[model samples]
Target: MISISDDVKVVENFVRVAQIIANLESILTQAKNLSLTAKNARVVALRAGDAALGFKPITNFIDEFSEQTIASTTKIADLSNQLFKVAHKLVRCSQYFHQMTLLKTHINSKQADAMYQEALKSQRRAASQLSLALSELENHFEDIQKQMQSAEYIAVTSRVEATNAGDFSDSLQSVSDFIASAAKTIKTAVVYNLSEIHTLRGVLK
Candidate 1:
């Protein structure tokens, strides 16, 4: 039942996964910059005396969240690379299987059908394993959602505390806003990747 069109579809899915992998590198770089910005914000808050006492926890939590963001993003990037490799390999396997079918169609020999069927079975097995890797990627991205939820909490807290922190309130607010914006980037990318993984899995099926 496999056709050239189906094979092309599968290859396209693999390319999308590779694209997502590429996107993660940029996200990580943004996270690193946000982390440094937060560190500087903490120092500014500390100099503001008792008026900025509430900012201590807010800035501390942001600092910690940024660290976790970098760690988890790196892990996700690694997973993406593995997923891309598997998906790309499956594309080649599918293409070869297609070529074998064209030969079988022309020869019209009983032996050719048998050979094609055997190769088809092997292709399906490889496809299943590759699909499982995609599932793992979705699960890993779910973990990132949890991480972003934590970051969201810290961002909200930072905003509220900065409001009452006096002369540096504007500066602190800007820091909180930037951190929240960075968290939004993480959230958007994770959602997009999960969607692509689902589509890629369907392509394999």
Candidate 2:
């Protein structure tokens, strides 16, 4: 039987997983917003004609950044889902193993012994799987951080280009501000999710 304390630990781990998922969702939302802002900036650049020529290329970079961020978040989301499933399996395996251990003390049958061994093996396998999932999640988190850095660079460049857009400087500056804000939002979410993943790792341990 799973003890009350064990049940509570499992619930806490689940909550951590939920928080990670929520943070990923926030990233996706902000990425979409960045994409829209990029499109609007492109329109403004076109209106400014030759005066905003440099800003036009910067808008393209913003669009690319948005696309890459969305793609990265999608991969992270899928990995996190996999991590969640593996964590659930680990919990079940632990519970079953615990039960078999309790049974071993009361029963002396060879079949019970065999079943107990099998449960132990399952628990080990689940633990290994969880480890692999956590490693993959860490990789994805690192990838996102790298992407955010590149996005930050693009945002900085956008601001520089915006100032050179002559009459369109105000409009372009607004778009640059949006890009910077979205980049910050996405980076914050990634950091938050990374911390949550670490908490989940601790809970599993």
Candidate 3:
């Protein structure tokens, strides 16, 4: 009976840890949103030409912030993995107690029923927490997809704008501008998609 009680406590702790993981995931989502917004701002500023003299500072700030956000997300992901490992151990412990309850069912039928009920409740709670975490993770991926599409559009627009601005005396200058614009677009899109893919993989794991 004491062991059964301990198992239940372990399960409860696991659930609490899972909830904390979910909250951290939500924070990650917010960080992604901030990163996307910063990138978009930089794109707009770049398009505004010299009139946007403040663009450089804003862009630099965004670059630093985005990097920090990514680092924080990585840390959170590592912590979440650790939490999941704990949950897995707790589940195994619960199963052992469950088997023990079954072995002496005739003598302690009522006690066994109570213990089983508690175990089932823990499982249900854990499952619900996992489901919520998955949903949030999926939403984060969706946001990334949207950001990628937006970046692609911005890149294409930048190319068109540069083309319309007229030919340069130096062919190399025209080529340089085109290449820079294209690279910016590609870089933003890649970052968004790669991060999203990584997050999805984490959720699946």
Number of the predicted model whose TM-score against the real structure is largest? 2
TM-score between model 1 and native: 0.84
Candidate 2 lowest-lDDT run of ten: 196-205
- Stretches of candidate 1 above 4 Å error? 1-7, 99-114
Winner on TM-score between 2 and 3 is 2
* Sort order, lDDT high to low: 2, 1, 3
Pairs that collide, model 2: none
| Candidate number with greatest lDDT | 2
**TM-score pick, better of 1 and 2:** 2
Off by over 4 Å in 3: 1-108, 164-205
Each candidate: what lDDT?
0.79, 0.86, 0.49
Q: Is candidate 1 or candidate 3 better by TM-score?
A: 1
User: Candidate 2 lDDT, tens digit per residue, 1-205?
Assistant: 6799889988988888888989999999998998899899999999999988888887888788788878888998898898889899999998899899988879989988999999999999999998998888888778878877887888788889888889889999988787778878888888888788788777886
Give per-residue lDDT, candidate 2, residue 51.
86
Q: Write the per-residue lDDT of candidate 3 for residues 13-85, one digit (tens) a residue.
A: 5555565455555545544554665565456556555544444354454445445545555564664565466
TM-score, every prediction = 0.84, 0.93, 0.43
